[model samples]
Target: MVVAIGLEGSANKLGVGIVKDGEVLSNCRRTYITPPGEGFLPKETAQHHRKHILPLIKEALEVAKMEPQDIDLICYTKGPGMGAPLVSVAVVARTIAQLWNKPIVGVNHCIGHIEMGRAITKCDNPTVLYVSGGNTQVIAYACNRYRIFGETIDIAVGNCLDRFARLVNLSNDPSPGYNIEQAALKGKKLLPLPYSVKGMDVSFSGILSHIEEKGRPLLKSGEYTVEDLCFSLQETVFAMLVETTERAMAHTGSQEVLLVGGVACNVRLQEMMAQMVKERGGIVYATDERYCIDNGAMIAQAGALLYASTGQPTPWDETYIRQRYRTDEVEVTWR
Candidate 1:
């Protein structure tokens, strides 16, 4: 039955998930939210994870209708995430491994998303667009590895949106990005923001600065509304992402596109990508908020795959947290 539990606390969210034989039995999560104009700090985020991880773990186990004895393996994100939050979750994973006497494996955060997306959507040989607060890349599977075809040269697409939301003092109740998405729905006129796409790689910093300079003064003068600012910015950035992803698809000769990551939940981004993919006669696959956003089940799924293929758990000494883990660094032997 090969049951596994995954611990994920890469950024503001902390999640626990239980999976058995590639099926996610339970996924529980808690998020740390800052004020409208602020972003969650590493220290604050780590504290939030620490306070809720134990309870969240219990919830996941109960929800999955399983006990610790049934769990064959434990998984934790060995990351490309904030140092404090990554360490906080990794410590818990290690502790539980010892307490439960179960095998443990450190999973790459990005690969976790890819594996879950593939498992849920059942897409084959798809060009992946991984967009999140901390990362933005167009990737393709090749030679037993998920290769990065293109990536952000500066701030990520999510970072660009969050920063712009912060600049406009958008509500952060659910998330700054969600708030911006909502506000953008009422956007009337498209603003002229820089569309920076240098071949496969995209840049968002210049557009962010340009929006601050051009949008802020007009907003203060009542010349532009928040909706207008959000709408224009979203349009510009998503277009850049779609363009680069298309380039990767053409280069890889792929007929399928899979969107995975926090930003993958955005409907507008999905629509834009779908339009482009349709023109190319390709399929576009995406999951809703449940699987797209950061969570534990994805890690568990990926970890279980690794354990199944290699039959070796990560040694305690080698299970250290990696703050700058790259997507391309992982070897996908399970494929």
Candidate 2:
């Protein structure tokens, strides 16, 4: 039985997963909430990783009924994330690899999300809509690579959500997205908001700002409910995603759509995407919380497949963080 242990300390999350032959046995994650005064601090994220990574790994192994020595391969997220967090995970993975005398593979965080979506939804040849705090892209598998059909020209969708949440003072508990979703549920009015889409690319900064400026006054004056603002925001953003995804599907001739990343967990977004795909007689696949959001299981899934096919490992010295790593930069070694 071949076993793999995956580690992920990419952004503010520390994750560990144990898998065997593509089956995820245990996946553990810890989220680090950035304090109000201190913005996304890399050093703090790394500190959180240092504190939680080992325990999470151990817990995953225990849940999987395996030991560190039982792992045939070790995998860690490599780049497209915060530098310090990546380094923290890489260090732990390297240490484990050296201790167990196992080969370690560095996995791309975006591809990890894609592969995990595939694993959970069992979708083949689907156009992927990946939206997170750091990324918002429409990807499709074609000609041995995942092609980026569309992406944000500036900020990401989740970033917009977080920013809007902060504007409304909704970041005290849960997640911004979650809080927004809850607020949207009680929404009663559809406030006009900017909807910007340039060719295949989309921009949310303007819309976010518009919401803050136009809706804030109404929210303050008790003219519009917070729910209404949240509803409108979700509608505008989800519409942009649906529009871009539909365009990508048509261009790529893909009939299946897979929604991945943290934002994929949004029930409203999922519903909207599913409705859009169904209207076109296409299928939409989405993972549950386990794989929808960032986690180590997906890293292990992608890394194990890459390792099996290539027998190559990213050199420790060569590993580095890429705040903007294109999906096409790395060839898909495993289909």
Candidate 3:
């Protein structure tokens, strides 16, 4: 059985996990929390990762009842994240690898999420809707790659929500997106927001601008409530996402839909996708925060798969990080 330790700190979350043969033995994370109306800075986030990574590593190993020498491989998210945070995690991963004399591999963060989603849900070849603070894409397996069927032309869906939350001074604890989702639950009115979807791609910057310029002023003037804004934002953005996902499914003939990412934990989004899939006589698969949100287990899972297939680790000098590693750029050899 392959035993791997995964490190992930692509954004504000610093996670460490131990996995054996696709099973997660330990998954622990520490999120960097900022004040309301303030977003996480890349440098600050990197510092947070540096401060907590060692403790998290020790906690993970302890929880798994393993030692550094027991680990056969070390895997870390190589990119498509903030450069500083990615580098911070990479430094720790490299040090661990050298200290333990274990093999090391760099895994794509997006592919890690997709792989972990499939593993946890047992859904094979599902059309995936990946939504997070940094990305938004509709993906499906084709030609040995996680091909992007649709994507955001501007800001990602989660980023849109996060910026809106800041506009409304939402708490950063837990997550601003989660707080928005909760506020949306109490919504009684659906305010109008721009619905911008150009063919296979969607644009959220316009919507975010509109909300901030129009919605917030109205909210300040007592013409609308935060719940109304939250409700309208979720409704409009989620509808666009579902529309694109449906089109992709129809095009790809995929009967299963998989939701993966930090934002994938949204119940309303899941419910919307489920309703659409149900109409098509298909099913939707999702996981809790442990698997849906950023975590180390996913990196470990994807890295372990690649390592098991190749039986090789990247040369130590070739482990440079990629800040813009696209999902389609990764060759799906394990699949």
Q: Write the per-residue lDDT of candidate 1 for residues 59-93, one digit (tens) a residue.
A: 99999998999899999999989999999999999
Question: Which lDDT tens digits does candidate 2 get at residues 154-193?
Answer: 8999989888887777763546788899999999899988
Clashes of each: 0, 0, 0
Q: Residue by residue across 1-335, what tens digits does model 3's lDDT show?
A: 89999999999988998889989999999999999999999999999999999999999999999998899999999998999999999998999898888999999999999999998999988999999999999999998899999999999999999999999999988999999999999998888888999999999999998888898578878988999999999999999999999999999999999999999999999999999999999999999999888999999999999899888897889797999999999888777
* Candidate 3 Cα errors over 4 Å, as ranges: none
Off by over 4 Å in 1: none
Q: Cα deviation of 93 in candidate 2 (Å)?
A: 1.3
Give lDDT per model, in order: 0.94, 0.86, 0.94
Judged by whole-model lDDT over C-alpha atoms, candidate 1 comes out at 0.94
Q: Give the candidate order by descending lDDT.
A: 1, 3, 2
- Angstrom error of the Cα, residue 75, model 1: value is 0.2
> What lDDT does candidate 3 reach at residue 69?
83
